[model samples]
Target: MSGQAAIVAHAQHWSGTPYHHRASLRGAGADCLGLIRGIWRAQCGAEPEPLPDYSPSWAEAGRDEALWQALMRHMTPAFVPADGQVLLFRLQSRALAKHLGIQCASGAQFIHACPRAGVVQAPLSAPWARRIVARFTFPAVFDRME
Candidate 1:
């Protein structure tokens, strides 16, 4: 397994985790960002900073791209799609980029904690692909070994 594979493996382990807003506990509950947080903890230890409480419509409620700015602070931008990349998505054309998911090993699918389905793997379909606004790699990727 490569470092990216290792990261995806960590995310795969949360496959059945229930979705819970503002929570990160696997199995019990986790939102999309919470799933990313859990994977970060598994691979990089403590989070660089605590996150403020946010509602489901947080991005729409504000014009600021808080999630994108925060991701920039903690991870490296990935110019190409690859396994284990953090994918940021904008649900609407003018909405702030808020949704997140981890690219799976296949690179054609992603794992996300969904409100309706909990943690599930979905294909990188055309519609989903279009929503992707950015990709990033965790800070710990450089230190990880296969």
Candidate 2:
């Protein structure tokens, strides 16, 4: 399998996991970031670094692009989104980019962990398009995996 194929497969495996703050385990529970973390572990070996504990209001209070910065450090920025890329979302224009999801099916859809709905593959609709702040793909090392 190609790296993008691996990512999509890994994400789909956790489709029914319940949403739990700061959790990363598949099926048991996971938040959006946790879902990404789980995929990273499966595809890239170990995580590059440890993650700090964060509260739901961390973004609103810090008022900084901390998450985006973190992602940039690990992934390559993508000018054109493609399948298997990670997407960062800002709930509102002024809010920090606090949400994450994996692009699927050549960017027509994305899979994300919704608060009440668990992990779901939803269309990349107009409303979601407006909130996208950045797009990135995993490091090249992952791209070569079969």
Candidate 3:
């Protein structure tokens, strides 16, 4: 399957998983980053690197775009939103970009792991769109995956 197809499929497979901070087991629990990590593993074979432990307030306390930096190291920057693209979100006007999701339906909607709802595909509404800090696509190798 193509990367876009593979990502969407993998996300669907993880739907309804319960939210658990720092967890990534499908059908059991997963956080926002866990959801992305799971998709990467499913679509790209293995993770490029191990992740460090982080707290819920890590982003605010660090005062750095750590999550954005990590994504840049593995994925290519995307100028236009598209299917399967990864989205980084900043919950507040001055907050660091931390939340993550996978664009779906040609960017009309996205699939993300909510704290209470777990993984769900929701419309990319105006509120969500305004929070987008950056967009990225997985490396070409991901697109070439079988």
Instruction: Please name the candidate that would achieve the greatest TM-score relative to the true structure.
Output: 1
Residues 40-141, candidate 1, lDDT per residue (tens digit)?
Answer: 887887888989766776247467788999999999999988999999999888778889999984778999988889988889889999999999999855
Ranked by TM-score, top first? 1, 2, 3
Model 3, 1-146: lDDT tens per residue?
77677777778778899989999888999998999988887677688888986765423644767789899999999997778888999887766788999989877899998887998889999999999989988776364222
Q: Answer with 1 or 3, whichever has the higher lDDT.
A: 1
Q: Please give the ranking of all candidate structures by lDDT, highest first, separated by commas.
A: 1, 2, 3
Candidate 1 wrong stretches, greater than 4 Å = 58-61, 142-146
The per-candidate count of clashes, in order, stands at: 0, 0, 0
Q: Residue by residue across 67-126, what tens digits does model 2's lDDT show?
A: 898999999999887888899999866667889999997888998887888888899998
Clashes of 2: 0
Clashes of 3: 0
Per-candidate Cα lDDT values, in order, are 0.86, 0.84, 0.83
* lDDT, candidate 1, at 109: 95
The true-versus-predicted C-alpha distance at residue 16 of model 3, in Å, is 0.4
